[model samples]
Target chain A: MEIDYSNIRVIGFDADDTLWVNETYFREAEEKVGMLLSHFETPNKIDQELFRMEIKNLPTYGYGIKGFVLSMVELSIELSNGTVSNKIISEILRIGKDMIDKPVQLLDGVEEVLISLSKDYKLILATKGDLLDQERKLEKSGLNQYFHHIEVLSEKQEANYQKLLNHLDINPTEFLMIGNSLKSDILPLINIGAKAIHVPFHTTWQHEKVERNATNGLNYKTVKSLREILNFFKQN
Target chain B: MEIDYSNIRVIGFDADDTLWVNETYFREAEEKVGMLLSHFETPNKIDQELFRMEIKNLPTYGYGIKGFVLSMVELSIELSNGTVSNKIISEILRIGKDMIDKPVQLLDGVEEVLISLSKDYKLILATKGDLLDQERKLEKSGLNQYFHHIEVLSEKQEANYQKLLNHLDINPTEFLMIGNSLKSDILPLINIGAKAIHVPFHTTWQHEKVERNATNGLNYKTVKSLREILNFFKQN
Candidate 1:
């Protein structure tokens, strides 16, 4: 798919998998949690239970370590037939805590693409995560220098995108959102009349996935890698 | 400071430092970038150069990677005597791209306090960031469950807060804004006739920083920690 990049003044990127390999790390931690849970419950059942807790707690907690820890606690109790030990709970908490310290690894060619795109378009790092964690990764990876502003937010929805546009003083039509998650990046950007580039990651974090059918009619283009963005810009 | 929790039917949270640490991460990264620039230019000069680029790009790109990368490239070119090496440029670009993979670490006790408050108040996560990044954090953190609605916005200005209240189908007076940034969370909430709790984070993110004093006579209280929220509830 081609897009006219000439008129586009600002390009907003969905951090995580778009510019770096965030989901894979998250998946690694999640898999570990799943393994821990499997010691007491079936993998499917553990996932179901945790998912139920997530849905139940979303309205009150929103997101982060507090919620993740609470979900583990809830899961442990359910899996252990109400006899979950404090050790098990603490172990889960420890794992949740440890995930935050994991090292960040960038996706291939992310730097070249960002630099190339930055020359022509205004760039923003629009990412979400625990503020400290996101900051640490940026600091460690040495990527924090490029963005003029780094937005660490709570969720990605239509309102968030609108707010970003307002803050940047840009129109949705002039903005381009690039990211991996269809649910968070593509859907929200498209809904707000902003252009979006969908870069599909091989392993999606559990929470970033959405029903594919919901992405209908969103003016989003797909790419397999970051370098494709240049081609997208050239063709458009 | 004291507030009546019983009268508060809805409690909103500011995403950045209020619930988690954000600015310190950026500061760290910025400092690192400054250090990198210092290898060729004076620290003050580097700061000035980067700040100028940031100010210029923010209005065009908003917040995130696009603006950041541009700033780095511009700085490199300026520092390199108008001749930027591909290697140095790539390094800068790498730093910009690496920001997405950062881990998410929640502020201490944020979850526990929010969980306790959720039982009594209709909780909402009112934060502004990159849409996709915020949602991913929310999902991963397991906090998405607590918020009946999650608002990821671009700015937390007065109008934005007002819009949030309107969207939630609630009155401003019935809501309380709890956050770290006095500018975005406190002032806006108070402007709309709502109560605000300012829980100052030790490190404030640059963008959300008030950069000024409160002008309006807002009904607000300042707290040092999230646990104080319980006290606010008891008093009111």
Candidate 2:
């Protein structure tokens, strides 16, 4: 089934990993946490525990470096049986601040794709994370000019995209979303009758990883890189 | 100079204290933190340090309970000279979770005013906080029906409001903003040439405090309660 490109008036790009190097930082932070708590558990166990902590606290803390740091702190205490040193906890805080301060590293050809698309479509950044953190990254990425505005979603479920289309005063058929996460950016949009293109990031968060069966019959395109998206709109 | 609100076409309400009990919870959390760290410093000193810590980290953490909790954890480690117990850190995390899980408490006459005004004007929630947190509160408050949608700003300054108006495609004269803080909700809107009404909350965060002269000549109304707003909009 060939998806029509003529109907999409607005295009939404996901920020983390899709536009910039994000999940890589999280992986680095997780490795740092594992090293910091080596006395309590092995690196693999620590990784498993940290993932559990994040999922457990997702409802209360949501997503972002701050919440991720909080989960690491909680996991540290639990894994160490309430004996985790204050120094280790302090180091975790530093790790979060460092992540927030890290320079915005745009993924390859992100700017080119955005510049090419912005001329023909109203481009928006539809992402799920801490609003300020994402805004700061956008400002630093120097791609703010190409976007109509940023839409920070709490979650990227089907209902969220529906509401976004409704808010933007565009129909689902008139919208297209491109992102790295199939769970967050692609499947939901496809389910909602909107077009989606997957630009797979080298690293994806464990929570964002979806099963192959989930994408089985979906009518969205998956490209090896974001730059390839330009090919689809060339003759428009 | 009698400011004319006859041209107002859209209204923005600040969610925190204007529609619900927000600052009060922060204050309570502060008191709890003071108790947790009493052994390390006097209550007065602990309060001062926490305020200083939050202000210093504001640029990195922005505004929200997750950041607040992170700040509290850092302060505990600082006050204890790196010996703060893991148990105390765990307790502070609990305080933050409790704050987030708190039920939305609407201020007096909030629903009545929303019900009356939502009929005649396009209403929106203009606020600064975690996006997920604010959306969750609106969902819990049952006042979601009154708002066309929620606008979460990273900061509620003159420039932010201007951007908001521009995005909504409404002129300053066509917009009215109602809220509790003179700094965030009132002055910024007025500075942007939008009509504003002040509804004072009993407790304002120290960071939100402004000098008397800042509001000396601003042409905006100050109401004692959210209910009083209904009177001003009756003619419309």
Candidate 3:
């Protein structure tokens, strides 16, 4: 479909993966975590167990590297039956720290797209993660200059999008969200009558991946890269 | 000191230890952590080391129990030189889990105070911590209805307060912040010329405690309890 965002006065961008490197780091960290626990379980089992732990710890740890670290600790003890070395635990913590400290490598042409969009649309960062971590990444990304508002939402369900748009005094018809996760960035906006474009990242976290049913009825466009998104804007 | 709050149009409440039980849990957990690590270091030394670790990890872990747990894990490995048993590590993880699961027990008269103040002044939750965790506590506290806006600041500094007030379209002269920590809640607001009331929580985090020099030149009220603050307001 030929998408038109001409009516949109506000454009919301997802911070992680879409604009900068995020999920890829999480993927690499999971590999390191698997290797750290290699003695207790197979690499595949460790990966499976880590996901379970992440889902279990969500209520307490919520989402982010902090939660991920905590889950790895929990899973290490479970997998090792309390035999995992303290040094290995420290290594896991280091993995999380390294992830948090990773440079905010923006996606290809992300800044150019944002720079172009900012002139015509009020841009906002709509993301969910550790508040300080997200702020640090945004600051490091040097892309904060392009955004009028920054939101670290807890989740991206339909109600959240509706509330966010309404809170900003934006009508659904005139709001557009460009992001990487269909679960987090695209489907929710489409469900709320707001326009959204899915700019798929190289790697998506398992939690954010959804089936076709979710996107079947959703009206949104998907672009290969952030650079392609500029073509959707009427101003450009 | 006799204080006047008649000029205050919006009253901000600090979350965590102020409205509900927070620091006390940390203290109890510290005691448990010390016992768990008693072989590695003296309880007194363990407590001191934990505080230092917390301060060190603030940049990565930020605040709240999740960071505290990570620091405890790091401290465990340090105290044991990587020989700390995985069972003890699991115990430390449990310490953190218990904290996050604790009920939001509002301080005596916190609800009544909020109820009374919400009638006349616009109430806002001004807090610093993990954003999602704070929101969860706020949701569990059942205090969401009282707030006109909720802010989970990354840090409580003069610049942050200035930015927050300006963004909310609030003037410093008309704003009042009531909380337990003088550093996080009182001084920052006072530095920006905002009215403030400090209702001391018994167990203050060492990081949140400041020397009397911090209070020397500052002009703000100190109340024995949250309930007493109602006397300062004309409504009650």
What DockQ score does model 1 reach against the true complex?
0.04
The digit string of per-residue lDDT tens for model 2 on A212-232 reads 998998899999999988888
**Native-contact recovery for every candidate?**
0.04, 0.90, 0.84
lDDT of 2 at B209: 99
lDDT of 2 by residue, B1-111 (tens): 666779999999999999999999999999999998999999999999999999999999999999999999999999999998989999999999999999999999999
lDDT of each: 0.70, 0.94, 0.87
Better candidate number, 1 or 2, judged by lDDT = 2
Candidate 3 residues lying further than 4 Å off, grouped into runs, are: A1-4, B1-6
TM-score head-to-head 1 vs 3, winner: 3
lDDT of 2 at A73: 92
DockQ of each: 0.04, 0.92, 0.80
Model 1: per-residue Cα lDDT over A179-221, one tens digit each: 8888888888878778888889888856778877787655678
TM-scores of the candidates are 0.52, 0.99, 0.96
Considering only N, C-alpha and C atoms within 3 Å, which residue pairs clash in candidate 3?
none
- State which candidate, 1 or 3, has the greater DockQ: 3
Worst lDDT window (10 residues) for model 2 chain B?
B227-236
Ranking by TM-score: 2, 3, 1
Quickly count the clashes in candidate 1: 48
Give the DockQ of candidate 2.
Answer: 0.92
